[model samples]
Structure formats: C-alpha cells, structure tokens
Target: MEKQDVTANEENDLDDVANSSTGNLVDWDGADDLAKPMNWPNTRKAKNIVVICYLTFLTPLGSTMFAPAIADVMGTFHSWDPLLASFVVSVWVLGYFFGPLFLGPCSELYGRLPVYLICNVLFMAFNIACAVAPNLSALIVFRFLAGTFGGCPITIGAGTFGDLIKPENRGKIIAVWSLGPLMGPILGPIAGGYVGQSIGWRWICWILAIASGVGAVASFICQEETYPAVLLERKVRRLKKETGNENLRTALNVDRKASHVFGRSIIRPLRMLFLSPIVGSLSLYQGFVYGYLYLLFTTFPLVFQNRYHFNTGTIGLTYLGMGVGSLIGLGVGGVVSDRLLTKLSARSGEKKPEYRLPPLIPSCFFLPIGLFWYGWAAQANAHWIVPILGTVCIGIGVNMVMMCVATYLIDAHPSFEASATAASTATRSLIGALVPLAGRSMYEKLGLGWGNSLLGFMALAMCPLPWVFWKYGERIRTSPRFQMKL
Candidate 1:
C-alpha cells in the first residue's frame, strides 16, 4: 500500500508540472496568444515600426545624397570621362540588383532582426571605406559594397509589417513606412548640396557613415525579432528547456544548412517572379515606377539648371515639390486604402487581399497624366512651377500605387511575403539601375516632351493592371499553387 501511494504521488507531481509547463509550449494556444506578434502591445509594435522606418530612410538618403557632389567628386579625382564619374553612382545601383534576391531569402532562414542588423553593420563599414578611399576605383568598390548591404531594409521590410499588423490595420502604417524612401530623394540632395558645396564631396560619404552608425546602434537596441517562424522556433527551444522534452518542436522546424538556405533564397524569388503571373505583372509595373524615380534623380539637375537656370543650391530645392507630394501620398493614400479595406471587409463579411487594391486604381491613371503634363510643361519651358506640379503628381501617384502592391502582396502570401517582396524588388532594382543610363540620352535626343511622353504611354499601357487584379485577384489567389504550397 505504501509503495503504491508513493508511485501515485509521483504521477500527480508529474501532472502538476506538465500543467505548469503549458506556458512554455512551442505552439500558440490560439490566435489570441500574446506571443504572436499580431497580438503584441501597441507600444511594442510602435517601437519596431519606428526603428524599421529609420533604417529604410538611411538607404535612399545615402543613395541620392551624393548626387550633387558627383561633379565635385569627378573634379577632385581629375576624371575626364563623364561616364566614369557616373559609374560611381551606377556601381551602387548595381548592388540594388543583387541584394534583394539574396538578402530577402536569408531573412527567412535567419530571423528578420539578425539579417537586418548584420547588413546594416556591413553597409556602414563600406560607407567609411567610401569616405576614405584613395582612388576613384576604391570609392566605386566601396559604394558598391555599401549598396549591396544597404538595400536589406526595404527588401525585408514588407514581411515585418505583415508579421505585426493585420491586413485591415496595415494601411496607415505602410504609408508612414513609405515616407522614408520617398522623402529621401528630396531631403538627401538638399543637405548634400549645402554640405558638399561648403565642405567637400568627401564629407557627403563621411556624414552618411556617421548617420548609419547611429541607425545601426538604435536598431540593435530597439528593433525586436519579428519573423513569426523565428518566434515560434524560440518558443520550441524554450519549451524543450522547461519540460526536459527533447522531442518538443514547432511547425517551423527545418534544416538550417547554409547551402540549402542560400539555394532556396536564390531560387524562390525566381519561382515567384516567373511562376506567379500576379507577382510578375505587378513587379514589372513597379519596375517602371522605380526606374522612373531614379531617372528623375539623375535628370532633374539637368532640367533645373538648363531650363530654370537654377544653381546647385536652388536645384536641390526643386526636389521639395516631390517632397510635399510624398507627404500627400502618405496621408491621402493611407486614408483611401484603409477606408476601402474597412468598407469592403464589412460588405464581404471577410477581409480579402482584394481590398488592398482599390486605391491603386486612381494612381494608375494619374501617373500618365502627370507624365504628359510634365513632358509638355518642361518641353515648352513653362513656368518652373508648372513642371513642379507634374512632379508632385508623379510622387503621389507612384507612391500610392507602390503602397497598394506591397500591402496587397503581403495579404496575398503571408508565409512567403519576404520572398515575394524580394522578387518584386529584383525587377524594380534592375530597372532602376539600367534605365538611368538611357534617361539622360533619351532626354537629350528625344527632348523632354517626347521622351517623357514615351514613358507616359508606357504607364498608360500598364494602367489595366490594378483593375484586372482588383476584379480577378481572388480567382488568381485561389489557384492551387499559391494557396497550397505557400
């Protein structure tokens, strides 16, 4: 009797311990589980969002801040060939082509935080290399290295948003997030012009390095781990520790081989781009938008200096028109997207990805309008303000459309949002790098009127994209492949 009682007591103790160990379980109890990022406190989510925004801001700021200093760099290096001078910026753009395809996949293998922070460190270090370079070749190599890592933030960022915010509540957050990239082209040159003119071109690189150092430190401290699978894996490890159960596992369990991780990262973006018509079409359109943006960065100086007779300092200020438009895009686009999502969700009795797309419609038509007006006004040498109006319209329309596609994609593929974003980014970055080469020649040969009109016609051809997706997206999404495999 005594032996049996002792065994019974042992069993009861084991049961109690098991009950107490529930907190450490690898799986979330339900959708309401606080461990899930979507259920994290508002304050906690805000911290992540703010840190991510700062990181995103650093990229575009670094890319274009050196623009006004380009001439000075060439003069200092005694570079007689204009193309070689342009190569400094072009090499950095080349990094944009490669970073997304690699880094985006790596984010899935490692957690978002680790991948982002590591890239930030490398990017900053390369900026220092750029600052102290002994020759033009050295500077070009460093700039390329910096850009290769610098693009990690924007590439991996859409996944972080999907991890934190539900589709219904994502619009305002996305708009705020987008402001960094849009405004960078505006603020960067403004600061770069004055600093480059007053101090020297080298200071532009030094200043960016310093700013990135601050960003890296802040990210290390404030940005929490956001990848859902990563969080679940952590829970699995913790549960194993607590329960002394070696078999504890989560759905995230997978091989961690560097080769396998890398191969998938390389191949997945290609698969998504080639296999999914939705991703391909949207990405191609986005490519045009991104390419156009870079073109503006390169071409604007020529336009303002030649047409408006603006000096460097004044030429930089011309970007402010687009800056204001960025703010408007954030405000107007966010409101319209959120309102549409809310209304559509209520009507359908379930929120669908299609809800994220209605706002894209307006932007589609408006872009060509801006392009044509901008072409004609700049062609006729109309008041500088007239061309500026076209810029504002372009800023708002392009960003609104961009915002819609990114958010819609997140909703469309929660499991592979990072990879999907990478695929889209690859197309866009490739165009951004290649198109600027043509932009100057195009404007010179065709003149602003016909050159921009050509771009406008291209924009018009792509306008059907939003409507097709808005109408048929559900059917496309329901295809066996995306729904099942992802």
Candidate 2:
C-alpha cells in the first residue's frame, strides 16, 4: 500500500508538471474558440492591428522627428559640439535599451494593452515636460524619461504581431504594421524640419505631445488584451469566480508563489538575450543595421546641407525617398513572405519557421548596393535624384530585412516571443543610442563617399547573417530551450 501511494504520488507530480507547460493549459474551444485572437473577426483584428501599429509609429517618430531640429536645439542650448547636441537624441534611445529588459517580461505577466496604454500615457506626459524644460540638461533628462515610456511599443509590438496573426500569414500582416515605424521616422523629419524652421524648436515637443495624446485615446478606447496566455488566465479567473471552484486552473501557468513567478518574469528577457543563441545572434545582426539607420538620421542633414545646399525644410523632403521605399518593401516583403510560405507548405505538407527567411536575402544585397551607390554618387556631386535613388533601395532593403528577422524570431519561439523580441530590441536600442555619437565625426572625416562606403561594407559583412540562420535555423531550434514541451 505504501508502494502504491508512492506510485500514485509520482503520477500526480507528473500531471502537475504537464499542467505547467502550455499544451495542457485551458485552451480555446478548439476551432471556434472566440477567446483565441487568431479566431477574431478580420475587422476586429484589423482594429487591434491599426492601434498597435500606431503605437509602434509613435516611438520612432518621437526619436527621429527631432533630428531636423537638432541644430536649433543646439543653438538654443548654447553648445557647438554636435555630439552634445546629439546626446538629446541619443539619450532617449538609451531608455529604449533598458525598458525592454523588464517591460517585455511584464507584458507576459500582465496583458499587452494595460502595459501599452500606461506606457503611452507616461511617454506623452514626459513629452510635455520636454517642451517646457528650462535648460539643455532638463531637456535631455526629460527626453530619456519620455523614451523609457515610449520604448514599450517597439519591444511589445512584435509580440502583438505574434499574438494576432499566424506564422504563415504574419509576413503580409507584419508588412502592413511595418509601415508605421518606417514611415514615422521619415515623416518626423519632414514635419519637424519645417516646424523647427518656422515656429520654434520647443514646439517640436509640443506637436508630438498633442499627436501622442490622440494615439493614447485610440489605444484606451479601441485596443483589447491580445496575449493568449493572459486571456486564458482571465478565463480561468472568471470560471473560478463563477463556479466557486478554486481548483480551476490553466495549462499556461502552474500554481506557484507570485513572488517566484515575478522573479523569473523579470529576468527572462535578459536571460533570453544572454543565454539563447537564436536571440543573441539575430540581435547582434539587426542591432548593427538598426544603429546604421540612426546614424543616417544624423547624417542626412549634413549631407544635404553641405553637398546639395538645400535648406532645412527641403532637406527633410529628401527623406520621402526612404518613406516610399518602406511602403514598397511592406508590400513586397509581406506578399512574398506569405505567398512563399503558402507555396512551400503546400509542397512539404507543413510550414516551418525557417521558411521565413527568403525575403531577407534580397535585403542583404540591396543594402550594399544602396550604400556604395549613395556614397560615390554624393561624392561625385551627381544629380540630387541619384543619391535619393540609393536611399530608396536602402529603405526597402532594411525594412524587409528587419521585418523578416522579427518574424523569424517570433516563429522560432512562439511561447517566448516577447522575450525574444526584447532581446532583439535591447541590442538594437543600445547600438542605436551609441552609434549616432560617432556619425557626425565619421561623416566629417570620411566625407559622404567613404563614410557611406564604410557603412556599406558593414552591411556586406552582415549579409551572411540571414543566410546562416536560414540554413541552420532548424538545428538551432532543436535546442531544448526553444522547443515547447509536450
């Protein structure tokens, strides 16, 4: 009888362990589970995506929109050092570096919407602070705080993509979402340059604060909790309350001390960044690329003002090339990614995460071409349209590559998509924050031709990154950590 009890206890323990993993959780009602976001109506899902994309758009917009106004801010602050002026821009990104380390995991514990709305409110309030700041120091400090709040969407938005869309269809859906971030930064300069040129530098912050207030309203009124685990947990809570059965639970979570769970949740993004090779490799690759994009933001004004003799407002117009390229990339990457998956799945009778990579291959090559072309063309003082053409290519390439990398990470680790994206965002943010400090110096020393050529070489070196993952990604996914336990 003692032996029988031991065996039964072992079985119970096994059951508890199984329950701790995802498959055993209180899942959606099979195919018709209204609770499952995947089953949400196309219109409802569209609304959720639109809000999420708008949220995504706001952060980069806030970061880059001020680029055109950097000189004005510098003059107002009474500084001539470009790097010191850039500190205002770079410091905000520094917040991006840390927010994801914790916020991404927090989204997992809480739901995406609460975290998003709260962060958006904080971001908007800090923008108001920045507008009214008395000194350069105060402005820098407020920008960092605003960035901390604004950083939420970039990290969490990828997880939003994972939540609402399936792997196969995610490409096109993701492309649509990609438009916001890509367009926002380009658009920021276009508007900000004119605003800073005409009205004043401080209004840069005022305008963003007003626009963000609108976004915050849409967020609170329209968005819903999209995290599946969180939704299931809510269902479990409702069932427990309704039936008076305390034992009712979900497979997504085990009954553990809240403290223990919270501790793990807090450290998960860091752990993913440090320990997971999949997350780390892609983070490093994309980080460098993202950093270059920011560096370009700093350089565009100098390049146009010095090389082409364009005024500030018209210099902002040059960014339209990149904006248009991003839209094209969105369509191309989205349609191709979805179609490729559909066709490949049809052939193999199933879909695999590795299939997410083909769209990125073109990006690798296009980036270098744009780099080399823009560098030499601007150096030669070719027609103004020539360098703009090169920028268009870079825009399309970078957008497609980034969207694919994000989708690949999401597909590889669906359970930990938020943490995975956090890892990627963490590196990207850190690199972006640090690299622009050197952008002015690099352009000054190398001139437009060699400076961009150097960047092009970096892009060429990174070309192998997507290919390496595409070839061996399945093997990497086989590691114990990436797999969902049965």
Candidate 3:
C-alpha cells in the first residue's frame, strides 16, 4: 500500500511541473481561454487601443503643435531671431534622447503601469507650465521638463503592447500601433495653426493637457500588468491563496543578488548602447534621417509663410501631404515586409530576422529623390503642389524606413527590445534636436534653392546605406555584438 501511494504522488508531482512550465510558455493571446488581455471582450480591447493611441497621439502633438505658431511667439515675446524660435520645436526632441536612458531601465524595475501613469501626469503638468510661462526662458525650461516626462510613455507603450499581444500576431497588431504616433504630427499642426493664430499659443498646451487627461483615465482602468515576471508573481499569490502553498514561486525569478541590485538598472542601457553593433549602426543611420526630417519640419512654416505667402491655417494644412504620405507608406510597407519575411524564411530553409531588410531598400532611393525634388521646388517657388508632392515622397520614404528599422530591431533583439529601442531613440532624438537650429543659418546663407539642395545632397549620399546593410545584414549580425540568438 505504501509503495503504491509513493508512485501516485510522484506522478502528480510530474504533472504539476509540466503544467507550470506550459503555462509560462503559452504566448499571450487575447482570445485564448487563459489569455489575460483576450479575456477582455473584443469591444474592450478596441477601446483600450483607441485610448492608448490617443494617449500616444498627445506626445508628438505636444512636440510640434506649437511649430506653426512660432512667428507669433517671437513677435509676442519680442524675440528678433528665427533660430531662437526653432529651438522651441527642437528642444522637445532633446528630451526624447536622454529620457529613455533612465526611464527605460526604471520601467523594467518598477513595472510599466505605475511609471506610465506617473510620467503622463508629469507631462500634463509641465505642458501646462509651458502654456502659462511668464517669459521665453521659463517656457523653454518648462517645455524641456514636459518633454522628459512625456518620453516615458513612448518607451512604455511598446512594452505594454508586448504584454497584451502574442508574438505570432504582433506584426499585424504593430501596424495598427504605428497609426497613433504617425497621426499625431499630422493632426497637431492643423489644429495648432488655427488655434494658436485665433486664440493663442497657450491654447495648444491646454488642448494637450485635456487630451492626455482622458488617456490617463482609460489606462488606469484597462492597462493591466503585462510583464511575465509580474504576472507570474500574481499567479503565485493566487495559488498560495487557493491551495495554501506559500512555496509556489516562479523558477524564472529566483531573487538573486543581481536581480535586486540597483546599479545594473543605470548601467544596462549604456552597456547595450556600446555592446550592440546592430543597435549602434541602425541607430546612427535612422537618427540622421529622422533628424533631417525634423530639420525640414522646422523649416516648413518659414518656407510657406515667407516664400509661398501662406497664412497660418493654410501653412498648417500643407502638412497634410506629409500625413497622407506616411499613411500610404505604412500600409504598403506593412504588407511588403510581412510578405518578404514569409518568402525569405521559405527560401533560406531557416528563418532569419535579417530577411526583413529587403522591403526597406526602396526607401533609401526614394528619400534622396524626394529630397532633391522638395528642396529645389521649394527654393524655386514652383507651384505649391510640386513642393508638396516632393514632401509626400519624403513622408512615404521616412515612414517605410522607420517601420523597417523599428521592426528589425525588435525582431532581432527580443530579449532586449526596450534597450535596443532606447538606443535607437537616443541617436534619433539627438539628431532631431540639433538639426533644426542650423536650418535658419543654412537657408539664409545659401538661399532657399541651394540651401535645400544641400539637404538633398546629404540624403543622396545616404542612399546606399540601406541597400548595403540589407545585403550584408546577416554577416554583420553574426558579429558578437549583434549575435542575437533569435
């Protein structure tokens, strides 16, 4: 009888071990019986995404919504120089570069939800300070702080999505996810141009605050803890309650000395920056393109207002080309990237994350072509549509390039997705912040035609980077620094 009982207990123990391991590996699918996010009805998930999208929208809108109103701000504040005014737009990006170094690590330690909520509130408060600033210096200071706070969500949003969605379906889901960030810049200047021209620049800040507040409430209700370690901890707690097994803990989280160490939190993002060549090279290339794009962004109002004789609202409407082009590019690229991945996997006889680069090759050529057209047309004062058409191409090219880089980086380094993204953001934002200050000086000295031609030349030079990278990416990724085991 004793021998029979021992065998039965051993069998039950094996079953329990199997169940625990299986639970950990089961990819999160919102529709699955055990899927936490899927447990919410379809309507609920849609609502959550919409709310998160809206929240995401406010960050970029806050970044550039004030751009169209810069002339008014200069006159109102009695500032004489345009370059100084450009700083107002570019400074936000400066925050974008630095904020992630700290915020990315902090989110990993504290969990995504708490950090997300706290930072959104801080963003709202500081943005309001920008609206009510007593002087230009104060406004600049407030804007910087607001941007630093706003930076948290952009990083956290990526992690939050991973928590909610499974890897198998994430490609399509991420396409929808791209919409929010893309739409914000489009919607921002349109509304901002009208609002700032009619009401005041302060209203731009008020509008952002209101929109962000709504997003915060929605997140509080719908956004749950998605990190697996966090989720497992909750599961352990629940099991302890149900079966009174206090020892029921996840093996993945052993609470080692390194786990509790705070120093790694500060060092890890920087370490990844130096150690990951894939992260470094991709970040550098993307950063320059992003910076050039923003440099153009800061220059747009001046080009239209002074050169084309457009009013503020009309100047804002011109950005519609950029917005429309981005949407078209995103749709086309999303389809092509997925198809390319499927085909490459079949042909290579093994899946490689580097196969994703082929779809991005066209953008390298298109970007330079668009730059030349946009630069020369705007400089020559060709009919407005010609310049807008060029800008449309630029937008499309940028969207595709961004989508490819973002997807590749995430796919290549899944274990360190947040850190990889942070590295990219750091490089991109630093360039975005610095490029605009030179716009005024460059355009003024060279005249619009040659000044823009100079920009075109730079884009033309960069055209080969994506193609070379795409062909050699497999070899490059094989290096120890980029040796992603994915």
Q: Against the unseen true structure, what C-alpha lDDT does each candidate score?
A: 0.80, 0.80, 0.73
Better of 1 and 2 by TM-score: 1
* Residue 26 of model 2, lDDT score: 53
User: Which model scores highest in lDDT?
Assistant: 1
- Model 1 CA lDDT for position 257: 71
**Model 3, runs deviating above 4 Å:** 1-47, 241-247, 254-266, 481-486
| Residue 224 miss distance in model 1 (angstroms) | 1.7
lDDT of 2 by residue, 91-141 (tens): 888898888766776776677988989988988899999999998889999
Q: What is the C-alpha RMSD of each candidate to the true structure, in Å?
A: 5.8, 7.3, 5.9
Candidate 2 CA-lDDT value: 0.80
Residues 167-194 of candidate 3 have per-residue lDDT tens digits of 4345555665665556676678889899
lDDT of 1 by residue, 1-486 (tens): 435643554444334335545533355545765657887779889888988899888888887777767788888888866556556665676787799867876787788998888998998899999989998888888988898898888888888888899777888888888777678767888888788888987888899999999889988888989887788777666556756887666654566577887877778777888888888899899988888877878778778888889876677787877787778888888898889889988998988888888878877777788889888999999999999899888888778877888888777877677677888888887887778878877988899999999999999999999999999999988889765544
Q: Once model 1 is optimally superposed onto the true structure by TM-score, how far is the C-alpha of residue 362 displaced, in angstroms?
A: 1.8
User: Model 2, residue 424: displacement in angstroms?
Assistant: 0.4
Cα error, candidate 2, residue 369 (Å):
1.1
Q: Order of candidates by TM-score, top first?
A: 1, 2, 3
Per TM-score, the best of the predicted structures is 1
Q: Which residue pairs show backbone clashes in model 3?
A: 30-38
